[model samples]
Target: MTLDALKIPETPVCAAALEVAVAYCSPALLNHSVRAYIWAAAYGEAQGIAFDPELLYVGSMFHDIALMPEFDNHTAGFDVASGHVAWVFGAGAGWPVTRRRRLVEVVISHMLDSVDVAADPEGHLLERSTSMDISGRHMDDFSAPFKAEVLRRYPRLGIAEEFLACFRDQAVRKPDSSPAASLRDNIAERILANQLDRTG
Candidate 1:
């Protein structure tokens, strides 16, 4: 499917989040963020899973912000720091307290091994989508045409190397962080082996 056939969230808050991501993240990182949302939303539609588009879009956009030095937290894991940033963005967007909390949950849960869709659809989608983008997990779930369209719109600009370097830095600074655990699990190989890199 082409992008025109897909339903991309275009609310004011979603636009603002995209602006922030584009302003802060590198070109590769920004494209990665947008591609993550596209994959999640498209997969959710194909699976008939109900999800909040605006929330998922916002979460996807801010999920990697903490990897950048401007927002990076020396103590907290990047996911944790990103969640805090998303929470503040939610508040600024006039979202209610519960909604802001939900945004934080989505941001943090993306780092988890799994998120039960019944419990949190947005979180589950984000987790699966990010995993697919970063490690090529569940790539067979999407049609080739759909994948091609996503790549055409948001080309991968050597994100594998850039993201690995960011995670490596995070691991060194926060040895107890989730990224450190990922490093131990050979995330480097996973990132490098991702088929998306070759497709792009």
Candidate 2:
């Protein structure tokens, strides 16, 4: 159950991308990002699909970078801003245009409800894994043992509260944006949860 089969690309590239991601994201967000990679890779394995591990890793790591207030561009949705950051990073690293575009697509497309995995396999896998992590969507797709192991290695670290704040921040900054439209209702629920946790 090692992840070696995913065929991750060069060490330096992976290392560099991770370094940037870890530096930019909060601890909870960072943990969530890492878990996204593991879950996506595990899902790909179960499907007998071969993904570009480097693309999956880097894309997953920075997929939510735009949610960070410091990095928020305000001009676009969080997904598009995150994609732009990855695109710029890849371009500066001298990655081929096609590869860089695909990487950006992987990050941006995860926000969509459906993606053409045949055209962007990494994006589809990322979406599945992210949905599982964020909303518990498709929770039954993986077995108990697999879920236990992944969670054991990387605990949630209270990501829900932290991510909710980030989501709210984005929503507030642009009321007409996707984040605002989607997360408006959850604000009350999360607030109630925070209050109940405090009382308990």
Candidate 3:
């Protein structure tokens, strides 16, 4: 489903939360995150899951706002974005501490822990099974020893299976292009399309 179709909560806090997250992210990443959120929310609805569309929207928007130049040198831009998202929205939202913690976890791990696109030479082929497995494992193994560092830092968060399912489907279905690459192409396309409209 398109983003327009989703019943995103229209509250000021929700909009403010999104605004802060988007402000720290690149335009391309912001757009891609919105697309991913819409996809995940739709999938949740289809499966009869109870997803808070606003929370999903906010979570997706801020998922990658942590891009600090030093920390993100070789990592994908989205990884950098994750840190800021947690800091800004999680701290600002005044959400239940547990909910805030989970939101941050979802943002940070959604792409990295779930969906392995590195093996596929072609970026766009949607592999649902691998994506689902990753999503399930992320929820199941979040408290594993390897993630203890993060858990210690965040302390109050946990991912639910249903929420993980939504995130997994979105990752599985994402266009093969890395989030950064997709956003770049999307921006270029929008610019060209706009220029063409004016000329035509």
Candidate 2 residue pairs in clash (backbone atoms < 3 Å): none
Each prediction's Cα lDDT score? 0.93, 0.78, 0.43
Task: Please estimate how well model 2 matches the true structure, expressed as its whole-model Cα lDDT.
Answer: 0.78
- Superior candidate under lDDT, 1 versus 2: 1
Q: Poorest 10 consecutive residues of model 2 by lDDT?
A: 191-200
Instruction: Give the Cα RMSD of candidate 2.
Output: 4.1
* Deviation of model 2 at 116, angstroms: 1.9
Query: For all candidates, what are the clash counts?
Result: 0, 0, 8
What lDDT score is found at residue 51 in candidate 1? 96
What does candidate 3's lDDT look like per residue over 10-97, in tens digits? 8776788667645654554444455445445545554455555655666666654543232232433444346455555566767777
Residues 131-188 of candidate 2: C-alpha lDDT, one tens digit per residue:
7777566677776666766666667777777777777777787787666765754543
| Each prediction's TM-score versus the true structure | 0.98, 0.86, 0.48
Error of 3 at 94 (Å): 1.7
Candidate achieving higher TM-score, 1 or 2: 1
Q: Of the candidates shown, which would achieve the greatest lDDT relative to the real structure?
A: 1
